[model samples]
Target chain A: MFSYCSDPETLSGLTWLSCYLTTGKHTSLYLSFGTVLLLLAITAPIALVFGFGGASAARSRFVPLSWLGKAYIGIVRGVPDIAFFLFFVIALDQAFEYLRHTIKCPDWDQPIRQGNDFVVCAAAKLPLGDAPQWVHETYGFFLAVLTFSIIFGAFAANVLYGAMQAVPRAQVETAEAYGMTHRQAFWRIMVPQMWVYALPGLSNLWMVLIKATPLLFLLGVEDIVYWARELGGTKTPKFTDYPHGDWRMWYFGALLVFYLLFTKVSEVVLGRIMRRLTHGQATMGGEAQRKAAA
Target chain B: MSCWDTVADYALRSVGIGERLLPRSDFTLCQQVTLIGSGMIWNIYFGTIALLSGFFLATALAMAKAAHSPLLRKPAEWFIFVFRGSPLFIQFFFAYFLFLSLKNVFPVFSPLTSAWAGALVVLFFNTSAYSAEIFYGAMQSIPKGDIEAADAYGMSGWPRFRRIIWPTMLRLAWPAYTNEAIFLFHATALVFFSGFPATQQMGDALYYANYFADKTFNPFIPYPILACYFILLTLTVIKLFGIVNQRLNRHLPQLQRGRIRLRPMLVR
Candidate 1:
C-alpha cells in the first residue's frame, strides 16, 4: 500500500484500491485460494482411496462386505450432498468429542445431551477450550474436508466401481492363467487398466470438487467466498482505506472467471490425456490411433 | 405437546397450512420427524417441477445444439457452458442477488425473493442445460442406420425427426436423463441454503434439519431423517423413471432392455 493511502482525501482510484486489496484481510483472501487448492489436493486422494476401497468391497466375493459398500455408496446418492456436508460437520464434531469425553472423563457422566445442550467434559473439547484461533479455524476446515471427502468418496466409489467392472473379463482370466492370485490379478492387471476408464469420471468429479469449494464458506471456513463477501461488504470511510461502491458483483464475477478459466484448462488437459491414454489400446481410441498411423 | 399434536400442527407446515412457530422446547422425535417431513414438500416441489418442465426445454436445446446452423447452435452451446461450468451454489446466490436488484426495478416481482419462484427458476435453467447436454450426446449417438432408413423412406425434416430421430434420442438419452433427475433432486436441498429466504419458517427438509440441529445442539437425529426422506424420494424417482425407460424401450427384446444403472454426474 502506498503511504498516500493513509488519507482518503489525497487518494486516487488505483492508489486506494492498491491499499485496499493489499490489506492483511485481502492477503487472507489470496491464501484462501491456497486453502481451496489444499483441500482439493488433500481430499482428492483420500476420497479416491475411500472410493477405491468401497468399489473393491462392493465387488468383493464376501456378501456382507459388498452390501456394506453398496449401502455406503447408495446412501449418499439419495440425500443432497450439501445436506450431508451440513450434517457430517456437526455430527463428526460431536462423535469426536463424544469419544474424547468417554475416554477423558470416564466417571463424569452428567449426560452429554442435556436438553438442548451438547455438553462434553472440559478436557474433551476439540482443540481444547483454550486453543488458539488458528486451531479452531483449522479444525473446522478439517471437518469440512472430511465431510466433502465422505460424500464425494461415495460418488467416486460409484464411478470407480463401474470403471473396475468395465475392465475386460478376459484380461482377469489371462492373469489367472498366468498364475497370479486374485489379489495380484486385481492390482497388477485390473487396477492399471481401469485408469483409462476411470479418468473421465474422475476428471468430472474433480471439476465438481472444484465447484464445490465455495461451499467451504457455508461450513464457516474463511475460504475465498467468505473473504469476497467480507471485503466487498459496505464500509464507511472510517474503517481503513479504499472505500468504494458495492463491488460484490465484481468480486463474485472475478471468482466466476477464475473457476471458468480453471475448468477450461482442465478440459484441455484432460482431452490431451484421453488422447494419450487411448493410443494403442483396444478401444475406439485405439482404432483412431490406427487410422492416424496409417 | 404429544407426538400426535406435533404432527397435527406441523405436518403441512412448509406450505403455510399449519404451525405458527416451530417447536422450541421439549423437542420430541415427532416434532423433528413431522417438521422435517413437512419441509420435504418444498424439496419435492422444486425437484419434480423443474425437472418435468426442463425435460422439454432440454430436448429442444439438444436439438438446437445438433442443428446445422451456427445461429441455432451458438446459444445452446453458451447456455450449456455457462450453467455447466459454474457452481450451482454460486448461481443461487448470484441469481438471488440479481433478482433482488430486479425486484427494485419492478416491485411487482417481489415474490422472486421467495424460494418457490426464484429457486425454481434457477433449478429450471440449471437442469435444462445439464439434461440438454445429455440429450445432445444421445442425439449424436443415435443409430446412423435408423436415420438413413428414415431418409430412404422419404421421411424428411419434421416427420423424420418425429418418428425416427426423436424416439431414438429419447431412448438413448433416458438412462442419462434419469441420472440427471436424481442429481437435480439432491441439488434441490441447496435452495434453502442459498440467498432465498424461507418465509414463515417454510423451508426444505435440509432447512428444518439444520434448525433442529441448531436447536438441539445435536445433529444426530434430524440430518439422518432428512437423508432417509431423500433416499426414499430418490428410490421413488428411480422407480418412476424406470417405468418411463421401460416404456421407451418397449420395442426392444427382453434381453436387450438395458437395466438402468445410476452414474454420478454433477447436477449443476
Candidate 2:
C-alpha cells in the first residue's frame, strides 16, 4: 500500500508491520467487521417483524393459528441452532430452486433429486449457474440472513408473547370501554406498553445475536472468523514476503477482545435505554425512579 | 447388514470401538439413526463432565465475586465478564491454538489439543463463568432477614453462611442454572465444528449429522434425527434438574416452590 511495501524483505521494523497490515487479505478482514455490523443492523429489525407476527398469531383467537405460532416458538428450543443454520440454508435453497424449476421448466422432468444430487435447469438456478462470484457470495449471505432471522425470530417471539401478556388486562379493557375495537386496543394500549417488559429479553437476544456472527463462517460468508483463520495461518517464505509461524492464537485473541468491548458497550447503552423506558411506568423500576426524582 | 447388526457395529463407533469405516453409499435410515445415536456418547460425555466440574468452580467464583476485598472480587468479575461476553465458538478456536502452542513447550499439555480434553476445558470455563454470574445474582437477592435470623441465634461467618446464605442462594439460582445446563449441552454440538479436529472420525452427534448431510446431500433426514436425540437429552436434563429443584425447595410449601421453566437461551 505504500512505497516501503515494495520490498518487504528489506524491511524489518514497525514499517514492515504497517505494510503487512495493509495487505489485501487484512483489508478484507477489516471490511468483514463491517459485514458483522451490517448483519446485526439488517437482521435485528427483520427478526423483530417476524417476531411480532409470530407473537400476534400465537395469541390469536383461532386455534390453528395459535398452534402454528406456538410450534414455531417451540421448534428452536430443544434443537441446537447450528443444526438449523446448516439445515435451513440447504432446505431453503432447494425449496426455492424446486419452486423455480417447476415454474421455469414445465415439461422437463429429469428428477430434481437424482439419488444424491439436486440438479435444476439453468433458468432455475439461484443467481443462475454462470453469474459473477459476487452474486453467488451475496446469495449465500442472503440465505444466512434469512436463517438467522428465522431462528432468532422464534426466540424473540417468545419474549414478545410474554411481554404482550404482561401488559395489564385492565388497560386493554379500558380501551374497549372507550368504544374502541379489539384491534384498536391491541395497537394503542397493548403494543405500546409491551416494550418495557420486552426490553430485558430483547437486549439479551441482541447480545446472543452479536456472539453468533462468528457462525457466519460456517455458512461460508467469509466473515471475520474466516479471515482470522486464513490470515493467521503460517505463510512460509515460498508463499509470501511476510512469513510468520502460526499467529492464529493472537488473531483469535484480538477477535475475543473486540467482542468483549462490543458487548460491554452494548450493556451500558441498553442499561440507559432501560432506565429511560421505565420512567413513570408501573413497574418497580419506575416506582424507584419516581421516588428518586421526588 | 441387518438393522440389529448395524446397531451392533456402530453403537460404539463414536468412541472408535467398532465399525472401522462409515457406510459410504446407499445410506439406510437404520445406519443414519444408529450412527448418529452412537455419536451422542460424546455429547453426553462432554456435557455431564463439564457441568459436574463447572458447578464447584462456579460456586467458588460466585463467592469470590461477592467478597469484600477488590483483590478477591476483580479477577472473578473479569473472568466471568470475558467468558460471558465472547462467543463460545471463538473461545474454542482460541483455546485450541493456545493449547497447540503449549503442547510444543511441554508434551504433557498435548492432550489439550484434542476435542475431548481441550473442548471440555473451554466448555468448563465457559459454563463456570455463566453459572457464577447467575449464582452471584442469586446471592445478592438472598433475603436479608434470613442472615439476620442466623446471627440472632449467635451464628456468624462460616456457620451463618452454611446454614442460611448458601441454601437460599442455591434455591434461588436452581431455575436459571437449569437453563444454563441445557444451553451448555446444546453448546457441546459446536465442539467439532470449531477449531478442534475430531480424530479417527470420533465426534459428537452434529459431526455425524454433518457427515451424512455431506455424503447423501439430503439434510432432511439426518438433521431431524439429531434434533430428536437432542430433544430427548433436553427432556432428561429438565426431569433430573426438576428433581433437584424439588429437593432444594422442599422446605417451602408447594405453592411457593418455583417450577423449572425451560426458557430458550439461544447462546451462552
Best by DockQ: 2
Q: What is the two-chain DockQ of model 2?
A: 0.82
Cα lDDT computed for each candidate against the true fold: 0.87, 0.94
* Model 2 chain A weakest 10-residue run by lDDT: A109-118
- Model 1 residue runs over 4 Å out of place are A12-19, A238-240
Instruction: Put down candidate 2 lDDT per residue, A1-294, tens digits, no spaces.
Output: 998699999998899999999999899999999999999999999999999999999998899999999998888898889999999988898989989999999998688889878888999999898899999999999999999999899999999999999999999999999999989999999998899999999999999999999999999899999999999999999999899999999999999999999999999999999999999888999999999999
Interface RMSD of each: 1.4, 0.9
lDDT of 2 at B242: 93
Candidate 1 residue lDDT tens string, B1-268: 6789888899999999977888888888988999999998998899989998998999999999999899999999999988888888888877777676678789977887778998999999999999999999999998899999998999998999899988899999888888899999989988888778988888888899999999898888998888889889989999999999999999999999878887666645
Docking band of candidate 1: medium
